[model samples]
Target: MGDWLRLTYFNGSLWRRFLIDYLFGIVVNNICAVVVAFVILPGDPFFHCWVFSMCIGSLVMWMADGCRILIWQGGRPSLPGLLGIFVVTIPVGYFGGSYLAAKLLALPVEAVLNRQIEHASPLLIMILIVCVFFAWFNWSQSELSELRAKAETEKAHMAAVERQAMQAQLQLLQAQIEPHMLFNTLANLQGLIALDAPRAQYMLDKLIHYLRASLSSSRAETTTLAHEFELMHAYLELMSVRMGARLTYSLTLPPELERFAIPPMLLQPLVENAIKHGLESKIEGGRVEVVAKRDDKRLKISVADDGLGLETGNGVHYPNHGTGLGVANVRERLRALHGDAASLTLEPNTPQGAIATLTLPYEP
Candidate 1:
């Protein structure tokens, strides 16, 4: 009952809404009083006739408005349904109001009915005009409301579709990236087995651990920066086993920023590219630093290495070797997820070697 009342009254305020209807009734009554005074009851005392017209007109308008509300509660009406309602309710309201007004005015019911019959044509025309206007008003309002609701529903559905597409694309990219890294690691293990059996065994163990964690995370759409860093840490450890003392790496992440979410497998490619093009080429090899920091509302992550820089003109460098497939994949994923709000850049590290930096919005 409460819910129905709330729906029936504007803004869920029944008394306030009723007051508005009362005000509307007053306005309509005044208009009817003017018409009655100048045309229908010209010979009657102006004040008395005006008062009588107010009583009848106000009652009729109120009842008509109530009937309109009731009809609309059942949903938008058909044209025939609307016409039927107006036909039944309007005349009923008119006759009931007129009978009551005649009694209050100390006039005979026959006298009032006779006067109304004499002015029947003009009165009928006026009633027809009022009915047409109100009917058109109701119809237009219902159509506009329906259009707005349809638009909102479509907007929500489109948003859901876009999200699904993004997840599917991310999964496809991850699938490609996983095999590339796995093949490269296996190749390195094959070479190390012949040169250093004990080191190869250690690298195999690390590879197993890395694969278990990475494979699980890759199945997910996103992971925290801390988890991605852990995967990278395992990969670097595997590399260390292969390179011995020649390769060194560091990973730094603030405790507060660790919870920020990023696409899974996002950072590992940058680390791999650094090792393949930067440290591996240097005879003595060098250090790689993976650092993540907060930059206002954004996150800044960089993979920096101290090795043979871009000056070496290494063809193996990203976008240069097979069009930097791995790097390009990373950039494409970032663009899809964040649009223009995220970016990946490669530049020379301060002293030597390449630095790959990624900047993206920090979503918690």
Candidate 2:
């Protein structure tokens, strides 16, 4: 409650604002006092005019700032409101300050008025000077407020433009992934058709099922872990038909994490990489295991395969040693989406083959 009153309601400390107002009041009143001393009261002492001007200016500044804080909540008031404040403040400040100044100087209030009237009437001249100063102050404040509002609008526009550009890049990367998987599968299917007819027909059926599941997921930005695991099962089954006994796979998805959201096809490329790069070229192909688990505040997923290890039959990695198209695509997408909070790393799996691990912050 104290914070609300002192900070939130006033948009800052009220005492600090009061000090600033009073400081400005002193400067303005000094200028007015000098003008009155020279032009209106040439014979009277300058010190007397200075005292009276200070008292009146301080009172007027206090009243004006108080009204602004209470009614407009520290925001700029309308022109009518600004004029009304001056209308009310001038009379009250003049009468109150006259009385106060006279008491301070040890004289009757009537004596101060009589002396002012003896010269060219300093009261009317002081009022004119104050009006001009305040009018300029309010105009400058209005322009500053407009400039601030324009800057905020431009900042929002730039953020929206940046968001749109990032989305477009994500879509373009996803577009590259779909065709890469499709062409590779089709090439394998063509080879199988000439070597084995019945097996090729079975593979075609599996491909139909795989495509149905994958086509929808490929178009989406995010999917549940359950759907992703299900898609992986279909894909592995299709690949198994082509590789015969050479390909073996397992998918482990915890029930608690089934509904968790991940970018669509985020795991598919990793699984494809494990099989194509780690196992396919070897005479005795090995197993591919895809596991998902939560670790502290992060999600950890690993695609491990026991096959020919990092080096293929030719001693060089398939597609480009462990950082192939699939790895590069996944890495780039992860970086774009999560910046430094997410990561993808390749390491040698225990005993044999390779492991691709993805780590990202877990959000429930």
Candidate 3:
């Protein structure tokens, strides 16, 4: 109720509407108020005297408040709503009743005429201004409600877009890891069979264990740091069987980082990239060193291999490099999971091989 009234005096530019609506209601009311006085004045002072009194009073108030109707129906008040506001009560009740009122009170027609001439005063003008402010109050509240509804609709739309974007990123990350891991494990198994059948069987078992973990975690971006390491350990053992005495690897993790959370299969890609492109291409074979540590609020991991390093691996696609899938998949996953909070980088190790390093926020 209060809100509708406030909206009437809105937009300083629409003052004309306010004035017109107000004048219409009061003009109609005064016409009726006169009829009332005419009938009750005993036909002595007839319509002449009746019109003189309330005609001005009704007009003043009608002009003051008719804008109230426009506000009630929202900023753009309908013609019908405006018409209804004044028509419903003025002509049928107040104006017609004024004549009846005079007789009931025993006031002569002359007395009513004198009343109108002196009625409007300084205080009445002040009262009229107060009423205009009251109407403006109701209009403002209604506009706020409309604005709130619009904002909520926009928020819902944006949330939907964000959800779809994240899902697409996760899918891309998962796809990159699978085939890359499969080919690397196959290469390791092939090398093992030529030397020792029994050891090759053990290598196959570790391969299966690591792949199972990867597949199991495919649907999730997050996995425990410990689970990720366990996968890495199994894969490194498979490589050990194939490399003979010419190749070796090590996994080192800080005590405090043991329970931190990270994306699944993140380190596997870098290690595989190091082995296939960084070390296997070299004449002397190599040592792949894997390290994980927490520095302040971030988790850092590095895979370094002593072999002919980065120059041989440049521009080689992940799917083509046998195990390059790990690098590409982890990269995509990092961007998706943390925006720019995590990154994977590659550079040549101190003197001999390539080093791939990953930095990610430490989530306890």
Candidate 4:
């Protein structure tokens, strides 16, 4: 009784369910009205059938909803339960509609109710057809909703797998870089140890400082721009010890941009490329500058070196010239992380050297 009186239906908004069901009832009832007037009860007026259908349909739909809410908790009921609800509700709807129509026309209730008794089989057949149609419609909608939910779950799983795979590839690329940088630094240190004892000790000390600063960020997936620049400063200081006056470097990070987050070791490889391919090749090695600035909504960082401006061959700037593994690593990482939103471009710096500029969507 409480369920029948309750405003809510099918775990949805009461008014929304009512409006939708009422609209569906109108459509279904009109179809049934046409069938009854033309085929089931020949010579019967279409207007009379339509009015009775409208009244019966409205009452039947309301009762069916109440039965579903009570017995099945508003979900689609079992086949037997569905049949029982229809059998009980259809007869009640027909009798109630008969009573209402009799009152409206000021006619005798017995005359109106007894009119359909002789054609009981046809009336029962019509009710059965409506019950089957409603059952099929409900089942199809439930199936479609389940399929849609399943598709969404599968899509989310695929995204998670793709993210994990990309992370693994990035880790492999980062691993390659650390060893390359370490080997070169160690090789230089070994040479200095034999030739100059004091400078070797100083280089070793600087190397320790650089490694200490890098350890934390190296293991992380992301780091702040300020931390990245600090690592670069330590790296440049270590290199300065080796090259003395030959290697001069500057890292410029605006205060506002310092807290922007980026993948770890993103700039390190760019800095390494500038030193190895650009400055180290020149007799009097020139400056390497790393500058970070905002280009509207994007973050742009450039590593520029004024040494042996890209070796031009056949009018091409970079291909014939030594770009190295660092360039490839940086490009792969950016692609995996930001897709088309991030890019790395190498162009000749004015008058001398090459500039590798990294552009990425700013994320804080």
Candidate 5:
């Protein structure tokens, strides 16, 4: 029943739409009758024989409207097509209704048609004028709808292009950061190998594992939260070996959100920033907590550290001249992916640390 109603009213079945058009034509014909009696044929007054004539006219108009709707529905609603239907149908309907009315009124068909032509020409002219305006209105609306659809298609195409550009920019940034991290780790390994071979070997094995996972993740545009967490865990473990008891870390991921997708390497830079600016600066190092949870319609991932808080004037000051390239990269990528719907915030954690919190739309 709901579907039937939708067909009658909405952009559904063409037959149902034609039925609505037919009904509207009947109303229009009656309104024309009122106008004819009041203004065009005041002496005749639309009574008796005139009412019968109008009824027959309404039926003819309804059939004409139905034919027009069917032709338009067949996808050839051009001006020429509409004009053709109108030219062929209008005279046939007018003359046929005149014949029917004459027969019902016990008059000669020729006499009735001649009388119609003489007296009711205004009503016929009004109907033709209304039909022309209706055709023009439909043509204008069709043009507007096509223009709107074309605009939407262009908008989507531009959005896709922008997304691709952002992805390319992110990949370039990752490429730059990855080699820097690798060179630093290798430099550290070179010194460690001379001083302590066993610790060096352990770090090497961790590096191998981290590199393998990172390579696999880099090949994909997106990764699951679980996989992202796994990569972060491997990185933190590698850092743990380097820092020993000086660096401690914890990872908490809810099982329900394990499958949530995020851009590859999104969280690692946050973790690296924490360790570099926060933990590495402190004398006793610090504990780093990486927590992931669902917050309303958003997924919140926070990287917090118990290290020296941000300097009074400078916010979350970094050790190496404070470029903040990693944080900026993450922010740009988030903007590209979710527009204004995602955010990354850097705030002071309680007591003595800095926290980087990332919030994005969550799809379950």
Candidate 6:
């Protein structure tokens, strides 16, 4: 449809445009006046034709230039400026085009050709042209203004819709994590009660504290770097109790990088994944390490563990989806939020094990 409109509106192939201007628009309109002149007075055909062309074509020129100046000079000017230019420019176009027409057509003189008395003054017709142009110009301006305002309104509405959708999705992710985490903690506490009643009670208290802290922070979509790291530590303590020190860990964080902002629970899933996939498969023991550092314009966090890494079957590195839940969720969240400014990469650790590293924009 757009292509068709362009083809239709811009169809005047050079010479066709010239013909429309001089022959169709200019010549045809004057021919009517020329016919009128012939009926009024019966002498001097040459004089009548020349007078008719000059008087009529001048008005055409006025309308053409007036439209251009009003619509095309970047923007329309004030009423006074427009009226000033219009009044002065119309007469100039009238006389100038008349002079050119006479010279080109080999008329003997460029002056008004007839001695006929004025039936209507040319000035009155000029005023009528101004009134017509103003009517058209005002209507066009009003339409353009409405279109621009509507476009802005639509743009703002779209932005608000996008923001609401984002917030809802973030809340949903948090909601999913909370119940899953609570169930896991309960499982750990139940096993502890069968073995050591005192330790089970301690674990219950810690679990309660963790839930309390989570409830306080639940309303916020983002948290301070220090708070997220603290949450990571608490989750690891529960995992440590469940695994019986089979998954020893280390956290090496630089001191000054603890004030940045990041999405809550963003790191917990990645850490959980490292333990679930990389450490749980091993029989003897392994360690998962959390390393955090601040680069010039980014915050880098890594979760690494020593155990079976990316699963290999039939010589293909196929991920174990049963244990890859947290890793997949973190990757999706990072991409949806930060675009290309953030990155999550999973690769082999030094000798054996999987390492997941996240590089995020450090918002202070």
Best by TM-score: 1
lDDT of 1 at 340: 96
Please give the TM-score that candidate 6 achieves against the real structure. 0.59
lDDT of 5 by residue, 1-364 (tens): 4554455456654455456555666666677677777788677647643564475556555665555455444233766777776776567777777787667767788877887778756756776886776556545655766787799999999989987887787788777667766887898899999999999999999999999988888767889999999999999998998889999999999999899989988899888888888888688999999999999999999999988766534553645412377787788778777889999998878887888999999888
| Model 2 worst lDDT window (10 residues) | 116-125
lDDT, candidate 2, 208-327, per-residue tens: 998899878777778899999999999899888877799988899999999999888888889888888777877888899999999999999999999777765576655554677788
- Provide the lDDT at 189 for model 6: 88
The residue-by-residue lDDT of candidate 1 on 51-74, one tens digit each, is 665665566556655655565552
lDDT, model 5, position 186 = 91
lDDT of 6 at 212: 66
lDDT of each residue in 1-364, candidate 4, tens digit only: 5655464534454456456766887899999899988998868778888777777777788888778767765456888898898889888877887678667667787877888667767886787778678667766755665687699899999999998898899999999899999999999999999999999999999999999999998978889999999999999999999999999988899999988999888998888888887888789999999999999889999999998878753565655343588888999999999999999998888888989999999765
lDDT of each: 0.79, 0.82, 0.63, 0.84, 0.77, 0.66
Write candidate 6's Cα lDDT for 103-210 as tens digits: 666775424423222433453364346445543554465467568769989999998898788778777776776777788789878888999998888788778766
lDDT of 2: 0.82
RMSD of each: 4.8, 6.8, 11.8, 4.9, 5.4, 11.8
TM-score result, candidate 4 = 0.76
How many backbone clashes are present in model 3?
Answer: 14
Error of 2 at 111 (Å): 15
> Worst 10-residue stretch by lDDT in candidate 4?
5-14
The residue pairs that clash in candidate 2, if any, are none
Q: For residues 201-307, what per-residue lDDT tens digits would candidate 3 score against the true structure? A: 98888777777866666567567777788888877777766666767878888777777777666777777777777666676788989888878888889888887
Root-mean-square deviation of Cα positions for candidate 4 versus the true structure, in angstroms:
4.9
Off by over 4 Å in 6: 1-135, 294-298, 311-323, 362-364
Give per-model TM-scores: 0.77, 0.66, 0.57, 0.76, 0.74, 0.59
Worst 10 residues of 1 by lDDT: 314-323
Candidate 3 least-lDDT 10 residues: 122-131
